[model samples]
Structure formats: structure tokens, C-alpha cells
Target: GFLSGRQENVLRDLRRQMTQAAEELRFERAARLRDQIMAVEQVLERQKVISARMVDQDVIAFVREDGSAAVQMFYIRGGKLIGQNHFVLEGAGEDADACEAVQEFVKQYYQTAAEIPQEVLLPCDIAEASIVQAWLRSRRGSKVEITVPVRGDKRRLVEMAQENALHALEQMRAEMRARLSNADRALRELAEALRLPEPPRRIECYDISNFQSEAFVGSMVVCENGEMAKSEYRRFRIRMHQDHPDDPRMIREVVSRRLSAGLEGEARFTKMPDLILVDGGQGQVSAAAAALDELGLAIPVCGLAKRFELLILPDEPEPVALPRNSQALYLVQRIRDEAHRFANAYRILLQGKKQTRSALLEVPGIGPTRARALIRKFGSVARMREATLEELAECPGMNRKAAEALYQYFRDAEVREEA
Candidate 1:
């Protein structure tokens, strides 16, 4: 998808490797390579097949506007030629439309092609079969064909095609092995970059969001194998105290409460993550560390500082800078962003509720008890307005007179201020 020269370079390398595999008698590898090439060709051929079928013709060839010629023929989905019988003949005379005839031919042809058995057909043409058989015979001829009539270049071509298929198969297997190895290597590099105790199997990150202790909330997100473990995530509402607004205390309380509750709860944090990350500098890390220490959890903790692209280690004087393109860095960014997103959403929800509560609670007659009763009964002030006086009186400590007064007060108040 880059420069044409780069694309050409890659194609040349692939061709060279394919040729080398074939020469080395690595039939399985060569077959795999051939299959890839065939699959790619099949994808390109989809347009041809679709257009040809729609046009109702056996497309012999087409020249693109760039003057590139492409030949088309019917084939089984498995890449085998469907044979000449696939074509149908139509039109009776000189004006007998050849194009219509070709189209008619292809329609019937494809139907038959779909019914072909999933095996190599015995090449009835001896010339074609013989060419392939001879080439196989040169190597292990007797082991090659059991059904086909064995000839000249056609026979050799068959043998070559078989060889290519076998090589492609081997290449596919080798490619898989190499891919697994590269993945392992990349994982190890990430582990080293993060100074993780081991290649992180799972990680948990925490972030706090608030507007000056109003609507304060914390969010925790989990990642497994460098991907989001959203199902395992948790969120917390800040309830301790608003005066100090200490983040360290907030984080500690969140972790402590979450872990403590997880001990016996359904949504338990029983599976400890390999690492822990906080979306702040050292102070957040220190808070998390203390909480984990108290809990006797030994997971390593670190921080992703917002100011710089540095990973803050516990008790370290300087944070470590990881390469911008590093997978390790990406993983940390994912965790931090997820935590921040969750925390921000939770905070917003709290803010919305707080604003609603402040407006209702500011009513002269509505103290905390009455406001809580109204919220609990009607869920919100808007809902309370829709309620009948009887429903309002149903609320604890709310008499009919008070309920009517409240309803009237709300109706008359203009620009009710939020807390």
C-alpha cells in the first residue's frame, strides 16, 4: 500500500522464495505459496465472475483502459478449470447473437461447475495427462496419477502445478511458525520495556475524575494480553470527604473497598492482574502501592504521567521514557485512556445527579430527609412533578398538605438554582 517500487520489491522477493522452495523439493511449502497466489487471484476474479455472470457470457478476455489484458474462464470454487463443456451455444443464424450465446453458455456451465466432485478429474485428454505424468514419473511417477490418462507439455504442466500446490502448503505452515515466533519476540520486548515482572498476562489501571470534589468518582479498567478486559472493569463513587479532596486517599479508598468487597461478591476481583497502572504520577502510584501492600497483593504498580510520555516507577527519582511506537507504550496508553474515559463518564453521571439534587434540596421546606425521600420515591424532581398529591403523600414524612405545597412551590419557582 506504499510506493509502487516497494510493492514490486516485495512481489519479486516472494517470487524468488517460491522459486527456491520449488527447487529445493519443498513441495508443501511451494504448495502453500501457490495457494496464496491463487487465493489472491480468486479475489481479483470475483469482479470478473460477477460481471460475466451478470452479462451472461463466457468472458474470453478484457482490456482495461490501461491496455492490460485479463483472461477469464469458468472454474470450480476450488481453483480447478470447469472444462469447455461449461459453455452453452445460442442464436440460430448469422444475426445469431454470439454474445447472447456466450452468456447462455456460461449460465449452464457454472451450474455444472458447482456440481464437480471435490477431486482431481481424470484428464480424458491423453496429451494433457501425459505431459504431467511424465514430469511426475521423472521424480516419483508411479506414485503420481492413478486415474488420469497420461502426454507432452500438458502433462508436465500438471506436474508443475501439483508441485506448486505442495510448496504453497509448506510455505503456509512455515509462515505460521514464523508468525508465532515473532509474536513471542514482540511480547518479550514489551515486557522488558515496561520492566514488568513477567510478560503481563493481565493488567489493571485506575483513574480519578472530578470537579473540585463535586461529583468525584474513580474508575478502574482491566486489560488482558494487551487488550481491553472491559467486562472485569469497576467504578466507584467518592463518598469519604470533600474538604481535603485528596486523590491518594480517594484511590486508596476505591481500591480497598473494591478489593474488600470482591472477597465475597459475585463481581469479584479474584484474579489478580500481573501489573497495576494509575493515570497519574508517583503520588497515585504510591497510593495504589500502599493499598495493595495492605491487602498483601504483590502485583507491580506503575503510573502513566499525563504531563510527559514517561512511565513513573514506584519510589523512582525519574520516570522512564518508552519509544513512541513501542507496543508497550500503546498498551499503557490504552489502559490509561480507558480508565480516564470510565472515570469521566462516572463523574458526569454524578454531576448530573448532584445538580438535580441541589435544585430540589434548595427548596425552603425540603431538607436532606425530604429531598432524599422525594428522590427515592420519584427518582427525580421532574418525575415528582408528574406525581399526584396522593403519590407525594405516600412518601415517608410527606403529608398531603406538604405534598400539595411542594407541588405548588415547584410549579411557581422560576430558574431553580442547582447546588
Candidate 2:
């Protein structure tokens, strides 16, 4: 071999002289001798080629609570050598012992590599390829191959991961499909739950509100595409009964008025509703349905039963129970609740005015007729404050003296009230 003891000793001596020359700044001579030293080292590494190429294809088996895994590696042959190359056997733990075990294996392998021994197999506690690569890199070594294979228990572990991944992919695809589906089909499903003919793309829900049926009012709210169409909403004042708070009769009146206006092509209520919803049980729904029939309209009708929040469809054996998280259920609930709130708010507005005006009109000089005339003339009590005695006299049926006296009384009353 070129790396014989005599030749190696000579090369070492040449290196030492080159170092001394560099210390003394002998640039030209140092450069020449450094080339000669490198030539000798190159020859020495050439003689060690057999030792480098005879590496065993080492394999490692790893086990965890999950399963088992394995890895394989081999040494490279024929390269310019300055230092040794190291490769990690995958499926090893991150503990210090796992590190030391690999170090010992590499060291022992290199020492007896010339003997061409059989492959060495080790037990690894971890199976992650990244972790194995990290451990090998820290050693400043190269020319190694690392691999982790699925087999035995390790096969089962990877199989589970693949199955879960497949299932997740399927679910994601299903969600995408849902978005592209027709909105009409979704509404049809909602209609089926309510036992309506086909799906109701356009729906109007009505709700009545009052304080003991005194200042009763009803509101009609429209919904399209499973959402509120706020612009189509309408409010109606109950001009019928002010005594009996019968929701059924109230529904009939409201639905009849709404349909009649829609049939007449009123600007705001021109379009006909596909379905009608009442915020009550079967009785209210029947009343509204009869009204629609009387108007010669074939609209489907349903009711949102208050008890248990059930959807009561006409002629259905039982109420349809929709899942609480369903979009269809939420859509109907929104329409019902909004109609109820609007009706109640309108009722409150009328009641507040009635309470204020009814008491004031009961005064000796001012009866309900005079009170109505005064309100019509003044627009509001606040505006009445700005009216002169002559303006009050101009109001129908008010004499000049009576108008003066009435104006003075209100001015005094407003002052006392503000105080």
C-alpha cells in the first residue's frame, strides 16, 4: 500500500515543515510543499478503498406502543476521502442511549470493516425518518443512506393513518359538493319537512301581537333562499276586533288582506308567496289557509307550533322534527321570530299612543271627536305646543274663546309635566 509507515512518516514531516514556513510568512515555499503533502495523503486514502467499500447494509427495527418499523443504510465506495461518512439507521429514539448506540456501531464497524462481516441489525425505538436524519447530521458525517420501511406491526400503524386520511378526504369532498348543489333542492327538502307541495322558494310568515287583543297588529315577513327578504316585509293594523284576541281570526284577516293586495298588483306586495307560515298551531294555520282559498289562491300553508318548536304541516300525521343544527330549521325559525318581533313592536307603538290620547280626550271640554280633530290638525302633541291661539281656533268646531282657554291649559300642563 502507498500508505506504508515509511511514506506516511515522510508526509507528516513535510506537513510540519510547511507549517513552520507559513509561520515565517514563506508564501512561495509553503505553497509548494503543501501540494507535495496533499499528494502523499491522497495516495494513503487510495490504499484504504477496500476498507471503505466493504460496509455491511445495516438494518434497524423499531418498536413503540403503536407498532414496529425498520430502516436500512449502506456505505459508499470510491471517493476523495478527508473524513469518514456516517448514516443514521432510522427507527431510533431521541434519547442519549440511542445516540451512543449508533456511535458505537459506527466505530466498531469501521474498525473491523476490512473483515467484510455480515450486516448488523439493531433495535430502534423510534420510526420517524426526520428524527433519524437529524441525529446523523449532528455527527458531521456523510456518505450514508437512511430508510424506514413499513412491515409487520409497522404496517398496521401506517394502514390506520392511510384509512383516516382517506376518510378526511371524503368528508372535504362532500362539503364542496353541498355548496354546488341547487338552492331549490335544499328548499325542497325543507318543504318536505313541512309537508308542502314541492319546495317553497318564496315564503311569507305572519304573526299577530297585542295586549289582550286591544291594540292588535300583525306583521308579514318574506323569506327567499332560506333567508329574510327584509325589503318585502309588511305591517298591518288590525281594524277588525279590539276585544277578543282570537289569533285564528286575526290570521285570516291578515292573510286575506295580504293576498288581496298582492293580487291587485300593489307596488309593494305584487309578488305572490309560495307558502304561508303562521306563528301558531293548526287552528291558526287553518284560518289562514281558508282565507287563501277564499281568495282563489292555491298557496300551501304551515304553522310553527310554539310547544316543542315543532313544524305543523297540514294533513300530516305528526309534526316534522328537524335537527337543531340544520340550516332549514334555522331559516324557518328566523322568519317566525322576526315576524313576531315586528308585530309586537307595532302593537306597542299603537298602544302607547292610545294610552296617551285616550286620557287627554276624556277631559270635559275635549271628547274623543274633538281629540281626534285636534290630533289631525296638530299632527302631534309636541307640534301642538308650537300652535298659536288663533291656529287652535282655526281647528274644526273650536270657538275663539274655547281655543284660547284650551291652549292655555295645555301650556300649563306641559310645564307641570316637564317639571
Candidate 3:
């Protein structure tokens, strides 16, 4: 969402790449490049020209507080707002000098920058203006001008960037805010951190619960604008590996079923989420990615491991440990936790419901203790029904006769229902 590049420049490069891919008969690569072009065009269409100078420049602003500063940079090419980004500089003096921080960024950034702008706009004059400008010019092989706009549209752009920097600083240092506007900011931060095409307006998080390999279930929790959309919450009864729970395979099944149903025009599955999060690490991410690949859906998928709260992205070697207090971390944790909660709740309900327990008690020699043991061993009434007599008899406190009786009860019930 931030510092991506000048949209037109990106779009031009993407179009060229797309054409090349097509000529090479790499249809998948061409399709991906086409998607990138469309995403950039969507962003470009919403741009508001911040300047009329028709020149390349970098607009810089900063917010300094508590010995730290956040610097926001706007990359303007041909007077259009191409891209923007923010940088956090800690270890500032108690005075929290923004100009010093901004100057430091310029010195370090331009050292290896691929492209240098003709002009650099700053909110205030740095200590060595002439020297810095001379160094920038040397790097650019042309004259570079540094200007501090006093008033007009240029000044307003600085103010806007400064405001954004303040927000960025606040998010990094504090707990997540509940306000809708703040949620919007958190979404933007997440998009930037994850390098998504844009901030996700609708996010779906999936989690699996198979405690003791009993009552396996999958949960799908939705967050719209960073708030839980309870109405959209869904639970899936994992149809495979009831006796032997395979979490990764189950995850693939859940995601595949959900997306396939949506594509099939089911009202409940319609309105696909912009992003998908699975509660796990690489295994879960890979499983979900495999499902998406099979379905030919290019939706972004990630995993959140509970142990370190690390974000595991597809094709990324290492997991991302977000800043402890960042909004992106908070937003992701919120969705992950909700999905876990929903999944566990469904599992608990399936295992503990009195109806299911009572049904077990009806079997010959199945007392309260035996019923509880069977539920723990087999997971649910559904699993018990699917169990073989030998498997049931192997359970604690269950005899062969009791297992036979239990099996017969299920069969007789099925027969009566059929009749």
C-alpha cells in the first residue's frame, strides 16, 4: 500500500512483462502480470494530483516525539502522487529533532537509490543543506535542488505526510485502537507489511480443532473493516481422518470446499474474502496454498503460528515477527484468536452435548463413566457411530458385548429411520 512505486511506471513495466510472458507462452505468468497491472491501475485511478509542477521530486515530512521520529516520504513523478512510505527512527535525542532524522534518511537512502529525483522537498532546513544538495547532485550526475515549501499546495502535502507519520508512530507504539478510522489505518499498515495489492477490506481466518483427535471441526471467522462479522462466521465438519486427524490435509479440504462453493454460486459462500489466514505455520500455509493453486484462485493466504505469534507467508522462507505493539500484529492476532475460539467452541459443543453423551449411555453396560470415556476416546457421537466394534471395544471400560450392543443400536436406529 505504501512506497510501491509510481503507478504509471509500474503499470508500464507490468504491461511490458505481461506481453513478454504471453509471447513466451507462459500463460500463468502473463495472467499474474495482468493482475498486477489491474491492481496498480485501481490505485492510480483514485490519485489526486498534489502538485502541478510536472517535475520529479520527493516530498519529506516527519513527526518527532519521545526521542523517536517517524519520517514520511512522498514520491512524486510528473507532479502525480506516485507512491509514499514512512520510516521510524529511534534513539533520537530528548529534543526529538525531526530535521536531523530526515537528514539522516536522505544521506543513507540516496547512497544506493536506483533513481534520484531532481528536487527534494523537506519540511525544514537541515544542518548542511548545501553540502547535502552537492552530494545528491554528484550522485545524480546533475544539479539537485533542496527546497522547503513555505505555503500553498506543496506545504499542504507536507502537512498530510506529517499527519500520516504521526499515525504510523502511534500504531507502532501503542495497543490497537477500536475506532473505524484507526482500523482503516491498521489495515493499511498490514497491507504494507505483507506487501498485498491493497488493504484487505474482507479477511477470512480459518482454524482447525481436533483435540485428542475427537470431533474434528474447522472454523472460518470473518473480519470486515477490522471488526468481527459474526453473521459470516462458519464451521465445517471435517469429513476426513476422523479417527486419525490430519490437520494440514483437513485445512486444505476446508479451504477448497469454501472457495469451490463460492465459485459454484452458493449464496452462503458468495462474496469471497480479500485475504485468507490459517492458524498455523508453514505446513498450514502450504496446505492452504495448495488448495488455492488447485482451484486456480490467486487469493493471498498466510499462517499465524501461536507459539511466537509469527506470520508465516506462502513462498517466504522465514516467518515475520511483527513489532510487539504494531497495529498489523494486533489485527492479525485478533483474527487468529477469533478463529481459534470459534473452532474450539464447536469442538467442545460436539464433545459435551448431553444428547450425544446420553446416546452413548443407552448402550448396554455404558454407564456415565463409560460414556465419558467413549466420548474422550472416539471424540463424538458421529465418530462413535463410524467406529468398528473392535475399535469401540478397545476403548477404556468398554467390553466386547457393550461394543456389539452399541454398534447394533446405531444400525437399528438407521433401519428405523429408513422405515
Candidate 4:
């Protein structure tokens, strides 16, 4: 029943269409076609034969290590292995035994499952085996069994599943090690290229985003050992140069604020970056370095020129240009790009807020004060459009007449959009 004769034909047609759409550069159409292909493929994957006997069953096994647990589930039907999946349990704790973890997993896993298998083979006996059996039987409308196999093919299957889980855990650890090694190597290269005493563990890159003096903002992106540290990223509104838009002056203000916070030991800015990268040439680097000097901090600073990819240092006439394929250059580019993205994202958000506020103000009887209150209460114009007359009336500063007018405004807008 997974794929009817007609369904199979439809799936083949969809796959062909997806290929053609992609070839023709209809990306949006191709994406929809691709999604349809995936849906059919998933059904086919679920219908894979797992046993010659055609008896549906699930083999569950788990391995716990280093404050985490990895659980594997093998789906079998018709004496063949249909599918296998592994899950990682973070913060599983040292005291929890494997049997307890398996029992907990069984209870939660089967709750949302569309089909309850005839049997579930576990790695070890669980206290809630009887209750789980009863629940499965009730849902399946037939007899169901939960067992732990000590010997035979069933036991071999459970052991294999356990091995799969352990293998997944090992792979995760290996990936972690590789990431750390690469980060260390990149940092070392950067330090050697810049003539630093040692590798800089934490680097911060700064960029400014604005549209002709509107929605001016600055972003600071952090990199620790060449990997992005997203939690340490920060954004600042360009308050000082909001009216007079000078990139150098804006960089000075942003760096001054960040350094002042670091000096005062503010939670986010308490730890200073080993190197500060500005997304501009000599002027921006000079401004940032001056700010650091004024604050009496000796943090190393450089600028990445957008046009030439030049690394401009403080008081240096010539820029340092590393090889095109250098790891140090890649790390600097990554951090600079992240800063630009964050600043641009903040600018877009501010633009959206401004547009929404102005749209709300366009409604009759809704002035700036009431518009601000509506935005605060509803969060967005789309949510406000979905609000009922009663809900709008209940908002602070909203009277029945004003609420009715706002509701009517959105209603007319929807009609116009539909037309």
C-alpha cells in the first residue's frame, strides 16, 4: 500500500518534471518538483523489505558514553532490514543506566508512531515492559510482544543495532576532533602571517550597514580559533553618526563603545578579541586603532579592503597580501562576511519595522502613539491583521471606534490583494 500502481507512475512523472525544470532554469518550479520527488522517495524507503517472513518488527539498542547516549533503531519486515536511524541524547547524565534510557525512549518513541510493530526487541529488560506491551497491543488492536533476545538471529540483530549506535557516537567524536584541529591550524597560520606573538584564539570583525543614512547599524561577529562564535556576535545602532554618515567616524564610535564595555567588564564584551578586523581599508583601520589607543588597550587590529582583499594594518603603508588559497585569508574572509551579513540583516529588520509602523499609521484614527502601542501589542502588522475586533479593542489605547477602523483597513487591503 506504500506505493500504488498509479502513485508510482505519478512519482516517475514528477521526477522527470523536476529534472526538466532544473535544466530550464526554473528554480522555484524545480524546487517544488524536487519536494514532490522526496515525498515519494520517503514512502518507498519506508516500504523496503526487511524480512522474508514479512513480520514487522523494531530492534532497539543504545550506547551511553561521556555524559551522552546514542540510540539506534532498526526497522525490519519480511526478514530484511528496511531502515535504521540513530539519535543522540545530550545530558543523559552519568547515573542513568542503559535499561532506563531504553525504557524512556520506548515510551516516547511509540507515542507518535503511526504503526506499532508486532514485536520490539530491546538491548536489555526494562521495568515498564509489561505496560509498554499492553499499550502497543491496544494501539495495534492485536497481540504485541516486547522481548530481550539472549541468543539466536534476533539477538544478533540487537547486537548489530548496538554496534551501529556506538559507531555513530565514534563518528561524532571524530568530527569534533577534526573541527578542533582545523581551527587550531587556521589560527596558527593567521598569527604567523600577521607576526603576532601567538595565535589569536578569539577574533572580532566589525562592519557597518546603511542605505544613504537610513537604518544605519554596525555588527560585530566573533571567531574563536577560526570557528564562528555566534553567541558573542553583537549589533549596535549608529546613534552618533545617524545624521552625518561618515564610515570612519561610525567605525570610531562602534569601536569606542565596544572597548568601553570591555574595560567595564560587561558580560558580553568582558573578553577582548585577540585581533579586531574592520571591513574597510586604511581609514577604517586607523579609526578603530585610534579608538583602541584612546582606551589604552593594545589589541591588534587590521582592515580587509573589499575591492582588493588587502589586509591593511595600523600605521603600515603597504597592505599584507597572503596567498589566494591561504587558510589565514579564508578565516579573515569568513569573519568579515559574517559581520556584513549580520549588519545587513539588522538593517533589513529595522526597515521592516519602519514600514510596518508607517502602514499602521496610515489607518484612520491611529496616530503614532496608538500605532506604537499596536506594534508593541501585536508584534507585526500581519498578526495585527489576524486579530479580532475584540482583541484589538482590548489593547491599551484602543477604543471600539479605532479598533473597528483598523480592522476594516486590513480587511480592505486583503480584498485588494485578492483582486
Candidate 5:
């Protein structure tokens, strides 16, 4: 009774410590303490006053579902459960021998573990039971026994472990199936809204970003089967009509370049999208359609207007208004937002490069060649600002005097900004 009371007190203290650890945001420490608390609780639950003898033991049970197997171990000390652990085995054959698997697990587990119990209980008898028992006895410095309980408290414990393993496997399978089902439903809804023959497995969205007529860039974001495919995304630096950059011209150039790459069988752009969405109103839709027409392609193109969240199609007389809560509309909005973000990111990168180049050129001694070298070496203006004078001097095409000038320029700029 004293031992049981002491164990309860330790469990209560561990629970309090775990709670405090979680409150302080020490998650790793909290997790370890939580495990200790669980082990203590399990031991208390398995306590049996009928068995006066205090003996340490382990009960192991095995269950298989599909091609996966779960082996659960319940650790008992002084006739009380101390803890439990489970191992999941993938590609374990459906008709594999459970006894042999359990035997192998026991051998491997006991080899590394410091503690070896006086007894081990299994649902089925292991082949080398005596040999394992001897090995365990040698480690424990006392006699060890291994048995398969027929119908007793030990057998009931084994059954419970097996049930737990099966339940865990079922939960995993349910979660996986639910994800696939949701993806399928979303794709179906998208297809029905767009009036396509089937779901658009590969969808691409485009957006253009620029400041006045400078640093014009377009981004193409890909989504396959209701999921964003970041690897397939492409960015283009608008080349045509650079002097007068407009949304229609930028959309046209991006779409044409992308279609040409696909036609030329570029590995990344070889797969044509089932649908193309442009981030604009009617003008963008018409521009994209004309680009595809020039290439003799018949891909479906639509435009999404941000103001009223309207969908504009090339052939439709008016824009289509989707339900506010529709899944299809949500998917379209996500794609459009991602495209805008990607394009804006490219624009910012180019603007930063321009500013860095201008700043370098403003310094009296640095010209185009030295400015390009510095930009290449430093990667960005922020990095150049943080660089030491010695590092700047060590860069190619830079000497002590030039390095000091470059460093002083950034320092002065910082002071000016602060002022």
C-alpha cells in the first residue's frame, strides 16, 4: 500500500510539472513529462491487490491490417502497468507468422533496453522462448519466465493491447481516405462550375506586376488536382513593348511565351494546363484567348476580377457570378492570390536590383563594371550594407579607398533615413 501511495504522489507531481512546462512553452520537456505521467497512470490502472507477490513483467500483443502490422507492449512492474509502446511495421505480409515477428521484436528490444523484467507474456507462444528467457535472466541476474496466457487477467491485457493497435490502424486509414475524398469533391465542384467535360486536373493562373513601366514581371502558378504545384510555376520578364507596359500586352506576351515553350517541348512546360486563369477582367481574358488562338490552341481561358470577384470568359457576354460560399470560387481565389504574390515578389527583387545598381553608380569611383561585380558578390543592397570594410576591399575590382567610399555611402544613407 505504501508503494502504491508513493507512485500516486509521483504521478501527481509529474502532472503538475508537465502543466507548468507547457505553460512556459517548453514543448519538448513537456512532452517527456507527459509521457512519464502517462506511464505512471497506466501502472496505477494495472495494479492488482489480489496478487500479493510483486513481480515485474511485460505483455506483448500483435495485430495486422492490410499490409501493416502493429506490435504493442505493456510494461508492468510490481504487478502494475508502468507504460506502453507500439511499433508499426509496413509491408508485413498478410499471412506472416505473428509468433516469429513477436520473437524478433523481443530480441531486438531487450538488446538495447537497460531493464529486463522477470516475466514476459505473449498472446502466442514464441519458438525460442527458453533461449530468450535465458538471455533476459542473464541481464536481470534472476530467473525469467515467458508464457502465453490462455484465459486470465494476462490474456485480457493482451486482448486490450491488440484492440488498441487495430483502432490506431483504422484511424490512420480513415484520415488518408478523408483527404482523398475531399480533394475529389473539390475537383468535381470546380469542373461543374466551369462546365468542363471533366475536372481540370492541371490548372494554371497568371498575374502581372510592375511600377509604372519599370520592372514588369509576370508569374504563372500551377495547381494540379486541387493542390498547388510550386515546382511547375514559371516567371517571365516582359520583353515585348517594354517602353509601354500594359496589363493586356503583358498578359499576351506571357501567355505566348509559355505556350511556345510547351510547343517546343521544354521539360518544365511540356504539360499543357487543362485551364488557364488570368488575374484581370475582360481585357485580360481576351488577350489570353488571342494568344492561344495565334498558336492554334483551344485551351479554356477565364479572368478573375478582384473588385466584385467576378469570372470573365472570352465567349460570355457578361461575367459569371459564383456563389459566395462555393468551393470552386474559393479554389479560383486561392490560385489568383498565389499568382499575384509570386509576380509581386519578382517585381520587388528587380526593383531592389535597380536601386542597388543606382546607388553603386552614384559613388564617384564605381562604374558599371565595378557596380555589377559588387552586386554579384553581395547579392543585395542589405547584404552590402552589413558587409565589413575589409570584406568590401577583398571583393574583385575593389581596393581599400573604393571599399571605404562604398561603406561610407551606406552609413550616410542610414543616418539620413534616421534623421
Candidate 6:
């Protein structure tokens, strides 16, 4: 419409200016104008006439896979498909959480959106439809409709948006893998530095987390081709004494159990890592090596000390140091950091469960069984604490007396906190 208006030759003249700039050696200016030209062309290509009312609308759909999601939005202006945009959200959960992903995108996106359309179309039903509609209406200063079309033309549009979203997500993943293709250089450097038979294609790093001597846990994080292989990650609850956890012994036990499971052909642990990295000095490396020896496995074992970034090999008494800024050392450090993060996550989860159990067990008529039931039903301590007497009584295996005791306990606790 703008082209058909007074500035009909704007795009044509813009292209001419870009070509003239290149001829005059203004490459940077030409490149920028070229980008803007391409953007306008893409907008033109996305336009398509459609059947709809006078109200402007935005159709939203998303696809999720492997902890990432892509949301596709189609803008409809005056019954025409004007254009669309795609957004990516990492750590957005799986396909079953599609509604939640869409809800999140909607809430966060509209906060920064320049304009709110009169109507919005969704691919699936969301629990906060009414709330979102209310907010949208307030923004628009009039009524706004949010619809999930079950059939017909609008449904087809939503399906199209979903397909586009899925395609965009796969493209993003492929681009990421392409960027990581240079991992071969890092792998080669590591192999040369360590004098290995070949580069370690699958490297696993382990770290331990605990408080004083309680809730000791070990985490094994994997890096294949310089990218984190999160699905292969494993966590262990130290079966040995937690009252005074021995770091080396805990590392040994975790490594032994993992290797044993793989040896026994466990479903998820059947594949052994090419190299093992422990988050400690010589002692941790020795412990991991001992585990391998007892199992008759010959995997390479190494340790990365936190301070000074020293690499400790099982066979070498003196620590081996790589270049200060070598990719090989950087890769090792990245893997170690991932292991630390995973171990801390597991530790935090255990600590939360411990606190929940302790708090619930203090309530009269609530034992371990009820406490476990409460956790299973409510999924968190905060949610359970907020449950009313009727809600608690309705929980599985909970009687009126136990529910009343919990209700009264929280109520009195709240009163004391207020005081």
C-alpha cells in the first residue's frame, strides 16, 4: 500500500542507491541498505489475502523438543496475512507442556509488543485464556477475543503456524550443530596434549556436592563433540556415609556404580565414556582409576583442580598443565563447570525435600507416610503449606483429622510469623 501510495518508486530507488553505493566503494553502507531491501521484500512475499472480519488478529502456535521451543506468530491485518515472526525459548520443557510454553510466550511477548490486536487465535487451549484476554482488552482499551478453533479455516491457519514453528526449531538446532562443527580442533588439541590413542569423542565429567557431610551427591555430565549431551547425564546419591563424606571415596563409588551398570547392559548406561574427568586433584583421579581397574576397564582418567587449573592424571604424580588459553583446557573446564552445576541442582532438590519432610513431620498426626503423600500430591512444600483444610482432606490417603492438624499447624505458624 505504501508503494502504491506517493512513494511508489521508494523500493526501486532504494535498490538503485545500493548499487550506486557499491560502485562508489561505499561497501558498508551498501550492505546495510541491502539488508533493509531484503527485509521489505520478505514482508511483501509473506502477504496473502484471507477471509476474516474487519478486526485485526494474531495467530500463535508453537512446537517444543528437547527442552527448547519455537513460537510462530501470524499477523492478520484487514483480512490479509501481512507477515509473521518466530521466537525461540530455551529450557521450555517438552511437547506435553505445549500449552504452558505458549502461555509463557504470550505473557512475555505482549509485554514488549508495540500493539495488541483485536483478536488472537491459539492452536491449543490454555488455562489462562480468561486472564490473558482481560489483560489484552485492557491494553487495547476495548473488547478482545481469544479463540482456539476446533475446525475449519482458522484451524488450518493454526496448523500451518505450528508446522512453520517446528521447521524453525529444527533449523535453529541444525545451525547450532554447524557452529559446533569446529569442535574437531579442540578434540585434536586435547588428544595431543594428553597423548591419547585418539580424540575423546565422549568425555564424561564428575563432581560431588554436599553440605558439611549430609546429602552427598555425585553428578556425571557428558560432552560429545564439544556440546553438552544432557540426556546422558546421571546423578548418584552416595550410599556410603554422608555424616562425614570422603570426597575421594564418594567419587570412587559413583564411578564404580556407573561402570558396573554399563557392564551389566543397563538400558540408559550401556555406553561407557571414552574419558573420565573428576573435579579434584590427584586423589580423585586415583580413585576413578581404581574403579576402572577393579572392573577390568581401561578408560582414561584425569582430574581438573579448581585452583590454578591443573590437570592431574592417574599415572602421573606431577600435575600436567596445558596452555593458559588452549581450547583443550577450555573444553575440560566447561565440562567440569557443567558437572558442578548438575551436582548442585541435585543437592538443592534433596535439600528442599529434606526441609519439606522436616516441616511436615513436626505437625501432629502427620508421619512419614502422610508427609510423602502430601509431597506427591502437592509437588512442593509451599503448595502444601497453602492448602486449606478441605483441600488437604481431599488429598489421597489423608483423613479429616490429619488435614485439620496440618491446617491448624500452618495457621498458627503464620500467626507467629506475623507477630
Tens digit of lDDT per residue, candidate 1, span 1-419?
A: 12343644555666677665544334356568756655544544443322122211221211111211111333323333332211112232344443343334323443444332222222232334455445444443244342332555334434444444344445445655544443344446557976765687777888888886577788989877644677998898878856556888888888777766756564667776677788888888899889888988777888899888688888889888888665566557767888999999988877776677788776666777787778877877778878877888789978777787787776776336432
User: Comparing candidate 4 with candidate 5, which one achieves the higher lDDT?
Assistant: 4
Better of 3 and 4 by TM-score: 4
Highest-TM-score candidate: 4
Alpha carbon lDDT of each predicted model: 0.61, 0.65, 0.84, 0.85, 0.84, 0.84
Estimated TM-score per prediction? Answer: 0.51, 0.51, 0.45, 0.82, 0.59, 0.63
Badly placed stretches (over 4 Å) of model 6 are 1-178, 394-397
- Please identify model 3 stretches exceeding 4 Å from their true place: 1-178, 354-419
Give the per-residue lDDT digits (tens) of candidate 6, residues 1-419. 46566333667877788765544334456668867775675567456676556668899987787777788988888888787888897767664477887888899889988989988999888899999999999988999989999899888889988998888788667645533544666688888878899999999999999986788999999998776789999999999864896889999999999999999999989988988999999888999999999999999889999998988898786888988767677678778988999999999999888889998999888899889889989989778778878999998889999999899898888899999
Q: Model 4, 80: alpha-carbon shift in Å?
A: 4.4
Candidate 2 regions off by >4 Å?
1-189, 195-199, 363-365, 376-379, 386-402
Q: What is the lDDT of residue 16 in candidate 4?
A: 82
By TM-score, highest first, what's the ranking? 4, 6, 5, 1, 2, 3
- The weakest ten consecutive residues by lDDT in model 3 span 172-181
Tell me the deviation in Å of residue 404 in model 4. 2.2
Residue range 1-419, candidate 5, lDDT tens digits: 33646876787788788755544334456679967776666666665442334888788899998878888887778866666777776545587788888888889889998788888888898899889988899998988899898887777888988997887678557645644555566668777777889988899999999987789899999988877789999999999765666899889999999999999998888999999999999999999999999999999999999999998999899888887766677678878989999999999998988888998999868888888899999898889999999999988999899999999999999999999
- The CA lDDT at 27 in model 3 is 40
Error of 2 at 354 (Å): 1.4
| Maximum-lDDT candidate | 4
True-structure lDDT of candidate 6: 0.84
TM-score of 1: 0.51
